[model samples]
Target: MRWSLTVLAVMVTTGCTGLELLVYPSDVLRIPEDTLHNLTLSLTFNTTQAFDAALNRSGSVLVVRVVPDEEWKLKIVNTPVQFTAQEVTEAACKTVMVSGYYWGHTRLSFYLTVNHVDDQFLPGVLLRDDVVVVVDRSAKLLDSFFIMGVTLFLICNTVNMGCQLDLKLIWQVLRKPVGPVCGFLSQFAFMPGVGEAPVTGCLHTTSLTISMFQFSYLIGWLIFEDPLQRLGLFTLGCCPGGILSNFITLLFSGDLNLSVTMTFISTLSAMGMMPLWMYTLGTSLTSENNYMKVPFANLAISLVSLTVPTGIGMFIKYKRPRWAEISNRLIKPITVLILVLFGAIGAYSSYKAFLMMNGAMLLAGLIITVAGYAFGAIMSKLCCLKRDKIIAISIETAFQNAGVCFIVLKLSLPTPERYPIMGSKDGHQASSVKFMKNVTFGPIGLRTSLWG
Candidate 1:
């Protein structure tokens, strides 16, 4: 048991660290002119075009040097190339490389283009200029989104804002007449490892942050939640944790039936109320003057993606009790693995963003994360909540569902050219320009929001 506990702690810690490591901002490196020049030369020089005899058709192929300066050691055996060749009938040094690196002050890119010649007997050498690389706005915008989410999460965490669910009441309910019944009912919806954790890591760090904040809020709500809210929160929406908690409780408490029933009730209520409550109050940004409402589409996606899988797991749990038990047992291990994977992806995306920009985003993210926890704790105490309730609220307020936030970001802002195309005079034709312009833009990848 001690080893198990230790392992869980380590897993959680590692996941958190991974989450923190990923998520970078845009505009951190500069593209070098020399790199571009080299890329251009490599593409045009190492490549060739031929008129086929057997097929009676024209074709072109390229073999590029693997490295810029390492002519001997870095040469590749055979690098296949299949770019539009008609544009590159030139052998000049006007080609460019599109790759960028952040280790140095100057970043580099590659480009290649064709030079048109009118004479029947053209010159032996051809030269042309093509392809321009610039920092795209979408990349910056994505940085902003991530920064905003992190900022809001920190603020909420600092202010102690989030769901204030009551735990003591829950425990009390477990000891009540319907506890066992609730526990039994909860079994219907409880699955094991599969849940929202993985999704949280995909688009934004906010989802994970927000969830922790919610947990904090629940702890806080234990003391301050209104009687009505308290009752509403206890009912289960038939999810994994519901039955698992109830089953665990039965080991210690004689009132197994009461524990079971209460668990069921809590699970059901949590699911039903989660959407409504989140829509109403679960956000970092809200105001009567103006507000950014999460679109219906994103909400639907989250519910479907997260809840349905759990529901299926629940169904499996009941249909195949032994299988369910086995699956449930695997939850701890799987949880660790999935979380690690999520952290890896999120961290990688974040790191890429970071390379593009300065350390401002990282600093901002840290500040916000800290602020979220602080505020959540304060709010819990001010609202007359107990320590446990405060803990829950703080967790919820601090962690935003990155997956949900990513979805929301994609729907709201989408591509940088979305506005240009939508605002353009050409109805659909605007898309082409918008897409082209977007390529030059930086990565506008999604990150988690701190609030609902």
Candidate 2:
């Protein structure tokens, strides 16, 4: 019995010794995409004699292969290398250098096999795995050009718009104040509701009885899983009309005066209403660190960008009628040019923002923009406003001052969270522009008169 047991132990030990073992280094390295990187893999085996025996069986050489899941995605240079026994092993580790190039984020695994025995592979290491690629040289140049070009266009457009403005007509509209009041309600009241509205009967649940407020909170929580995203949407909804509305109004032959007036009033009102909304709804979405500080500087900039060139144009119109007339005639061509720049240069600068769009945010943004347009149109009609004024109000209500939104985001969130919100804003802007051009403006061609 003792002899049989001893033979069995020897057989088990022999079976265990027959297997080969390899240990990889515990460190991980992260490299950029589309860049060359040298990866050093150190291989450690159980015993030198075992290594020698395996090498001898494999013609005095061992092979190291890169085993990537997507073979085509990872390009390995100097792979499947053969190392002879004479290659130096420092500190009991045989180091192999592998060079590779990858344009995207992926994991690359390495494996070593000798004497028909397969050793375990290293866990795949990821390179350049972020959804938004790093901004390189070309993007920076495009962005700078975009900024300068858009600024020039806006100044020219706003000045031309100012030439068309009649102070008497503006005062008359303000004195009556019906159209402006409706626009204010649409921007502050209905728009916020559209942005913060909750889902009802989402799960089709019968037993659960929840309040409207609770359901709203629950829906917001689910839709914006990230706090920063929720803040972005909320701030976007609360933002006042931007200067872009004046251009859109001019394009459609709406009341440019009403558009400019509404933009100015809304921007001013934001100092108060923005704080109120942020204090009430914004407090619930994020921590105290994100507490909304009324961005007075951005608001001042918005006011200056809108008013100064406009005031200059008003002066030019008051002093030089022919010059004003010439500038006024150029409005359509310049408006077209500005729109084109928004599409072309804006796209180049904001392509990274496009990559971060997702289904939930897309749906919400569409809903808000469409609903704002519908609300503005309805409210203006109820207020007994003219068609031109209706067009102005609708455009104003639909497009928010995204610049302010961006400033607020920069102030409130960290780098990681800011990216997704900016992306959401960019996607929303692109979709809104498409909706306006194809659905709204295409049906009704540009009207000749500035005011109906």
**Candidate achieving the largest lDDT:** 2
Candidate 2 — which pairs collide?
none
What's model 2's lDDT at 401? 74
Give residue 181's error in model 1 in angstroms: 27
Each prediction's RMSD to truth: 20.0, 13.4
Q: Residue 437 of model 2: what lDDT?
A: 20
lDDT of 1 by residue, 1-452 (tens): 00000000000111211110100111123333223212323222121222112112223322222222222212222222233233223332233233333211111111112212111222222121111222222243444554465444333321111011123444675565232232222222221001123332342245344343233223213422232121111111112122222222222322333333333343344445444433332322112222323444544543443334444554554566666566545544543443354435445544534444323323333443455456645655666654544444343333333333333323322232233223223332223222222111112112232122
TM-score on alpha carbons, each prediction? 0.35, 0.64
- Candidate 1's C-alpha runs over 4 A off are 1-93, 101-294, 312-330, 345-351, 383-388, 411-452
lDDT of 2 by residue, 1-452 (tens): 00000000000112233322232322233333334444444333356656565554443444556554545444566665455443323213343333323222233444444323224322222211111211111224655666677778778788888999899999998999888899898888766433334434543131122122111223334566555455556666777888777888899999988899899999999998888767766665555444566787888788889999999889999999999999888988988876875666555544433443446655556666676688899999988889999999999988877667656654654332233322344343212222222211111101101110
Task: After superposing candidate 2 on the true structure, give the runs of residues whose Cα lies further than 4 Å from its correct spot.
Answer: 1-139, 195-224, 416-452
Task: Give the best candidate by TM-score.
Answer: 2
lDDT per prediction?
A: 0.30, 0.56
